[model samples]
Target chain A: MDTDSPAGRARGPYAKSAERRRQIVDEAYRMFSTRGYQASSLREIAGAAGISLSNLQHHFASKEELLLAVLERRDETPAAETAAADTAENADENAAVPFDAAMVARAAANERIPGLIALYSVLSAEGVTDGHPGREFFLRRYDSLRAGYTAEFEEVRRQGRLRSGVDPAMAAASVVALWEGIQLQWLYAPDRIHAADALRAYLDLVIVSADDEGADA
Target chain B: MDTDSPAGRARGPYAKSAERRRQIVDEAYRMFSTRGYQASSLREIAGAAGISLSNLQHHFASKEELLLAVLERRDETPAAETAAADTAENADENAAVPFDAAMVARAAANERIPGLIALYSVLSAEGVTDGHPGREFFLRRYDSLRAGYTAEFEEVRRQGRLRSGVDPAMAAASVVALWEGIQLQWLYAPDRIHAADALRAYLDLVIVSADDEGADA
Candidate 1:
C-alpha cells in the first residue's frame, strides 16, 4: 500500500493523487455497504467522496473499476495480513497458540472499522449467487484463507499443538464458518454478541492440550 | 404446510391458486438471492414467476411483502422444524448431543433449497445497515433463535449433556455463527467445503464428555 518512494513522497501531485484515491475508496466502501453494489451510483459515490463526477471518472473509468479498487484495498491486503499472522504463529517454536486472545483482538480491531466490515458482510452475501461480479473474488478468498487455516492446523498438528483426531480441512472450514457466523451476528447485534469471545471459546475447545484431559468441557 | 382437506385437495381453482403462490415465492427467492433486495424489481419478479405483474402484486402487495412471505415460508417454518428436532433431542435421556451432525443434516437439506438459502445469505448481509426494511425481521429472528438455542443448551446442561464449564448463551451464539458461516461457504464453494461435516466436527469438540477425552480432536 505504501508504494511511495522518498522522491514520490516529496512530489506534491503524487501525494495528492494517493490521498484522493484513498478518500474515494473509503467513501465508496461506506456507500457500497449502505446502499449495496447494484443500487449505488457513481454520482453518489463521487458526491460522497467530495469530488466532481468527471474527477472521479478520471481516477476510475467506471463503477466496476472503482469497486475493484475498493475490494482490493478492503479484502485482498488484509488477507495477506492474516496469512502473515498465521505464518508468524507457525514460526514460534515455543509459543503457545493464543487462538482465543487472537480472535478477541481481531474482533476488537473489527469494531473500529465498521464500514469495511459492513462492506464485507453485505457484499459477502451479495456475491454468493451465480455470475455476480464479486463471486470470483470471494471464492478466491475462501480458497486461500481455508488453505492457510488448513496449513496452520497441519503444522500445529506436527508440533502436537492441534488435538488428535482433528481433520485439518474440517477445522479450517469450521474456522471460516465461525468467523462468518460471528461477524454476521456482531453486525446484526453488536451489543448482544461478543465475536472475539465466541471465537476464543471455539478455539479453546478445538485446540486441546495434554493437560486439558482433566479440564472441564 | 399441508392444509389440504379432501374438499380443498379436490378443488382445481384452490390448487391452482396455491401453486401460483408457490411459484411466485420460488421466483422471488431466486431473484432476491441473485440481484439482491434493493436492486431487484417487482416487474422482474413477476416476469420470472411467469405471472402477470398485477397478479403477482395481488398475491404479494409489494416486493417487501413478498420478501416477508419468502422469509416466513423458507426460514420461519424450517426454524420451527429445527426447534421441534431440538425438543425431540432433549427428550432423549440417553442421547449424546450430536449438535454438529444435526447441523450438517440441516445444511445438506438446505442445499436442496438453494434459492431459499441464497435468499437468506444475500438478504442477511443487505439488512445490516440502517433503514433496510428487512432489518427488524432479521434482528428479531436472531434474538429469538439465539434465545431458543440458549434455552436448549441450558436444559441439556441440566441433564448433564452439555460439557461442564460451557456457557449456554455463548454456545448458542457459536452454533448460530457456525450455521451462518458454513452456509455462506457452501454457497460460495459447494465442492470444496462440506458445510454439515465441518459443523459436526466443531460440535464434537465443544460438546465433549469424559469419553471424548481419548477421542480425536
Candidate 2:
C-alpha cells in the first residue's frame, strides 16, 4: 500500500542523478573521439555538457573515472556482437563462428556508431605506456579479444575450414590486428580505405572452401 | 680541398651543433617510448639530453619538429627490411618479397630500439583527430604502406605463393594492420605478449603452398 510514496521518491532525484551521470558519460565519450583525453580538460567536458563543474564532479569526480565509464559502455559493441554470434550458432555452442569477411567488412565500413570506432582507435593507441590510467583495462581487453578469436580460429581449423598450415592461434591474432588496423585507417581516411572489402579479402584467404585451387583454376 | 680552411671553420661549430641536435633527437625518441608524446614536456626532454632549453630550441623549436625527426629515423626500419629483401630476391624487382612473418615477428618482439615502436604507436593514436599535427604524416604513411605492401602481396600472389582466394590488395592492408596491431600490443605488454610469435603465426596462415590441401588430404 505504501509502494507509491517510496516509488515516487526513488523516481524523483535519483532518476535525475542517473540522467546526469549518463549525460556526463556521453559528453566524455564524444570528446574521446575528437579532442581526446589529453586535449580536453574536465572543465571543458562539463562545459560541453552544459553542466556546472560541481555537477559533473558529483557524477564522475575525475577524468579517469569518466574514461572507465566510457570504456564500460564501449564494451557493449563487441559484447553485443558476440552475443548475436552466439545466438546464431546456438545449436552448437562449440561450433566455430564462421568468419563472415565480406559481411563484417561491409558492416565495419558503413557502421552506424562511428564514434565507437574513433574512441577505440585513439584510446587503445594511447593506452600503451607504463602507468596510463586505462592500461589495465586495455590489456585485459586485448587478452580477452585475442583469446576469443584464437579459440574461434582453432575450432575452425580443427574442422578443416581453415588451411592446413594456417595456425589457428596466429590467424586469431592476425584477425584482431586486421580489425584494429582497419579501424585506425578508417578513422583517419574514411573515404580512401574500405574496411569491409579489405577484411573480406583477408577472410577469403583464410577461410578454406572445399576446393580453393580448383575453383580458381 | 684546402687542409684546414673554410671547410674546417664550418666544421667546428657545425659539428657541435649537429651533435647537440642528435642528442636531443635521441632523448626525445627514448622518452617517446616510455613517457609518450602527449605526456613528455619539452623541458623534460631537454633535461634528459643534458641540454639547456635554449639549445634544445636551436634544434627543434617545438614538439612537432622533434617528432618528425624521430619518425624520419623510424622509416629506416622498413627501408632496411625491404632493402634486405631486395638483395635476397636478386635483380628481380617484381619479386613477391615473401612475407617473412617469423623474422618480422621476431624482430618486432625483440627490437633493440623499442622506443621507435613505442613512439609510433603513441603518436599514431594521437594523430587520429581531424587536424592534429601528425595527421597528414600518418595518413600519407598508411597510404604508402598499403600501396607498397599491396604491390608486394600482388607479386606474391602472381608467384602463386599466396592462398588462391586471397586478394592481394586486401592481404596488403591486412599485413599493414597486422604489424600495427601487433606493435600496439607489444608496446603495452612486451613480456606477456610476444609480437613476433603472433605475427609469424599469422604469416603461416596466409602464405600458400603446393599442397595446402592435397598434401593434407
Candidate 3:
C-alpha cells in the first residue's frame, strides 16, 4: 500500500483513467441534455471533455455504452441511490418510506436539475424505437418503475389508504405515466407544472386521508 | 375547366406534385416511427421513398420542415380533424361530445395504429429540448389540450360528475400526462397496457357515473 511501491505506481494511471472516464461521462450527460443524444457526437463529447475520441472509446466502447454510463451516472446520484437501496430493503418490510413517497421526493429533486429531466424525457421517449440504444434501458426502467409503484399502491390499499375500488396496478401505471408526461410538460412550461405538485395532486385523488378514510371506506 | 385546356393541363403537374409531397411525408412518417427522428437520416428517408436528396429537399427544404410535415400529417387525420372541428363548435355549446370523451375515442383509435403512437411518443418527448422542431407543435398541442380538458372537467363539475374537492385544472393536466405516459408504456408492453382502459380507469377516479353521482354528491 506504500505510495512509493510498484503497485501504487501502477495504480496511478488506472486511477487517472477512472477520473478521465468520469469526466467523459459528465460531458456526455451535459451534451445529451443540451444537444440531445442524436446531435451529441462522440467526437464532440470527447473534445468537450478534453480527450480524443479513441481515448474516450477506451472508456466507453460505443455511444450506446456511453449513453448507458450517463444514465447510470444519474441513477448513482444520492436520491436515486437511496431509492435503489430502499427497493432492496422493501422486500424485508423495513423500508423507511413507501415507493410513491420516494418518487415524490425524487420528483422534487428533479425540479432542481432541469437538464437531467430533459435528458430523461427525450431519451426515454426516443428509446421507444425498435433499435435505439436506450430502448432496453427504458423498457427495463419502466417495467421496474411500474412494478415498484404497483407494490407500493397495493400496500396502501391493504392499509385502506387507497380510494375505494381504485385498482393499485392501474394507479401505478397512471402515476408512472403522469410523471413522465408532467416532466415533459414542465420542460416546456417550468413555471406552471411542478412535478411534486402534480404527483401530490394525483396521489390525493387516489389516496384517502386517515380522517376521511373512516367515513369513506 | 376542360381537361384539354392549358389551365387544366397545368393543374395536372400541381396535383402530381402534391401527391409526391404526400409520398415524402408518408415515407418520413414511417421512418420517424420505426427509426426515430435522430436516427432517420434525410438521405435514408429519401432513399426509402425512392427520391433523391435534392428532390426531397425541394419538397421539404429541411429535416425540421420534413418533421413538421410528418407531425402535421398525423394531426390532419380524421380523429384530430374532428377534435379541431369540435373545439371550434364548442364555443357555441353545440359540440356533440365533451373533450375528455373525445380523447377516449381518440385513444381507442390510437390503439389501432401503434406506429403513429410511437412517432408521437418519441417526438413529443424529444421535442422538449430547446430547438426541436416538434417543440412548438407539442407546446401548442398541450396548451390547447389542457385548456380543452379543463373546460370539459369544469362542465363535469357543474353537473356534479367530477369527484368532490378535485381541482379541474390539475385533473386536466394529469389526464393529459397519463395519456402520453401510458402510450409509451403500451409501446414497450403492448398487451399489458391498453390506452382506453388506462384512460377510463383514471377518469373513473375523478368522474362519477350518472347513477353514482346522486349518491356521491
Candidate 4:
C-alpha cells in the first residue's frame, strides 16, 4: 500500500506522525492550560494547530481523549523528576544543603504557567471520584512523586542530613500534603497567597541542616 | 387562609417538620457519602429516608441543596480541638490531648457514621471549584478551624504548654494541612490508613512535651 495518501501528505516527511501528534498535543495543552478544559473547545485546538476538526478527530477522538493525551504528555516530561532519585549517584554531595533551593525555585517558577496550576487544582478536585479519567492518573502521579521524595529523603538519611529519627515516609507525605493543602488555599485566595512561597517555607522547615537547626530555632 | 391545608398537614407539626428535615438531610448525607454526589439520586435518598421525592424536594429544592444543608449541619458540630496554649480556669482539661487509639475506638464503637466521613472526603475533593456551593462553605470552615487552632496554640503558649520560638500560626496551618493531606490518602486507600489515626499521630508529634524530646530523639 502507498504511504503517501492525503493523511500521509498532511503529516509531512520532515514531520512524522508522532511529531504531528506532539504538535497537536502541545497546542491542546496550551489551549487547555489557558482557557481551561471546559472552556477550550476541540475546534479551537484544531484551529490553533492549523488542522481540520476531522483531522484532529483522526488524531484524538474526543476532548477527553485529548485531555488524557495532554496529561500523559506532561507525565512523560522530565520536569516531573520521578527518576531523579534513582539516577543520582552522588546524592551525598547536596546532603549538607539546608534545602533543595533549586527545586523549590523551579516549582515556584511553575506558578507562572498560566492556567496550568488552576487546571491541576480543578482536575484534582474532580479526580476524587472512582471512575473519573484523571483518577488513576493522579493516584499514580502522587505515588510516583511520593516515591521520588522518599528516595531523596533516604539519600539525606544516608548522608546524615536528616534530623535524628525522622520518619522519611511520613515527612515526605507531609510535604506532599502541605503542597496540596496550600494549593487549595491558593485556589481560594489567589490574590492573598503565594502557593510556591508557602510551599518553600514549609520545605525550609523540613530540610533544615544540623547546623541550621540552632539558627532556625 | 387555612393553616392546616393538605400541604401543611403533610408537613406535620412544627417540631415534626424540623425533625423530618433533619432526618431527610441525614439520609441524603448517607447516600451522597457512599455513592458520591453525581451518582446518588434524590429518589434514592428519599427511598432511604422512607419519603417520596416530592416530600424531600419540599424540604430541599435540589440534591445540591440537601448536600449543602447536611454540610451546614455538620459545621455546627464541634471540631477537633485546636492545640490550645492556655487552659482557661473552666475550660475542658482534656482539650489538648492528641486524638489517639481511644478516640478511634470510640468512633468505631459508635453508630458507624462512616457516611459522615465519606461525605466529608467526597465533598472536600469536589468542593475545590470556584462556584461549587461547598466552596465558600469549606473556605470559611477551614478558616474557622485554622483560627480556632491558632487561638488554642496561643493559649497553650500563655499557659506554658507549647515550646518557645514556635510560630503558632504556621504550626496550626501545618496541622490543618497534614489533616487534609492524610484525608486524601484515606479516600484512595481506606484499608491502608485511617484519617483519624494519622491526624492523631501528627498531633502527638506537635504536642510532645519539651522534656520528652530526648525520649523522641
Point out the worst 10-residue segment of candidate 3 chain A by lDDT.
Answer: A82-91
Docking class of 2: medium
Pairs clashing within candidate 4: B84-B152, B84-B156, B85-B152, B85-B155, B85-B156, B85-B157, B86-B155, B86-B156
Q: List-wise, what DockQ does each model earn?
A: 0.66, 0.50, 0.69, 0.24
Which is better, 2 or 4, measured by TM-score? 2
Stretches of candidate 2 off by over 4 Å are A1-10, A75-110, A210-217, B1-10, B75-110, B209-217
Report the lDDT tens digits of candidate 4 across residue range A1-217. 2266666665566466678789899898776544445546889999999999998898899888888887767546655332212112333446554335544654565555525555565455445654556678667766765676778777666665665545677666666666666656655556654556655655544455646442222
Residue A131 of model 1 has an lDDT of 62
So what's the TM-score on candidate 2?
0.79
Kindly report which residue pairs in candidate 1 clash with one another. Answer: A164-B217, B104-B196
lDDT of 1 by residue, A135-209 (tens): 887788778767877776676566566766788778787877787778888888888777778867877666767
Arrange candidates by DockQ, highest first: which order? 3, 1, 2, 4
Better of 1 and 4 by lDDT: 1
Instruction: Give fnat for candidates 1, 2 and onward, in order.
Output: 0.86, 0.68, 0.79, 0.26
- Runs of candidate 1 with Cα error greater than 4 angstroms are A1-13, A75-100, A210-217, B1-20, B50-55, B75-101, B209-217
Writing each residue's lDDT as its tens digit, candidate 2 over A123-197 gives 787776666688888788777766776776666666667755666666666666777777777777777776767
lDDT score for residue B186 of model 1 = 84
Per-residue lDDT tens digits of candidate 1, residues B1-217?
A: 3346555646867787788988898788777877788888889989987778999988888888988877776433545243312322333333463444555566666666666677777888888876888898888878876787787677656655676567889988888788778888888877776666776676666566645433322
TM-score leaderboard ranking: 3, 1, 2, 4
User: Best-fitting candidate, measured by TM-score?
Assistant: 3
Each prediction's whole-model lDDT (CA): 0.71, 0.66, 0.77, 0.59
Better of 2 and 4 by DockQ: 2
